[model samples]
Target: MMDDFLTVIALIISLNAVICLYRAAVGPTTQDRVLGVNIVGTKALVVVVLVTFIQTESFFLDVALVYALLLFVVTVAVSRYLEAEGWKEVA
Candidate 1:
């Protein structure tokens, strides 16, 4: 019963991630796009953690931790790159 509940919650989080994907793709501003991507990554991390619980596996938790670190690095890199662009507008 708890497994079923976790599965349902994971599915809901996945759906939310998909919805955030649209914002990542269609956001009007670069900052908004970055935020959307970060949100999606966060949701994915949550799903991975949920899977770890559902499957009673310890490896998935490690994978989730690595993925979360990767997500943070990428988001910071992109945000810094954008910031360093210094008010330049893409034509």
Candidate 2:
């Protein structure tokens, strides 16, 4: 029963990530797109953590941590890049 619940939650989070993809692709502004991507990444991280609990795999938690770090670094880097002088015009 608990496994089924986790599965449903994971599926919901995955669907939300897909919806976020549309926002990331068709957002009116670059900032919106970036925020959408960040949201999707955060959803993915939640799914990964859920999977760890559902599958009873400790390694997945490690993967989630790494994924979280990568997501943070990339988001920060992209945000910094978007804030640059030349990118301001594009934004």
Worst 10 residues of 1 by lDDT: 82-91
lDDT of each: 0.93, 0.93
Per-residue alpha-carbon lDDT of candidate 2 for residues 16-59, written as tens digits (9 for 90 to 100):
89998999998999888989999999999999999999999999
Name the Cα RMSD for model 2: 1.6
Clashing pairs in 1: none
The alpha-carbon deviation from the true structure for residue 73 of candidate 1, after best TM-score superposition, in angstroms, is 0.8
Per-residue lDDT tens digits for candidate 1, residues 1-91, read: 9999999999999999999999989888888899999999999999999999999999999999999999999999998889884577553
- Candidate 2 — which pairs collide? none
Report RMSD (Å) for each prediction in the order shown. Answer: 1.5, 1.6
Candidate 1: lDDT over CA atoms?
0.93
How well does candidate 1 match the true structure in TM-score terms? 0.91
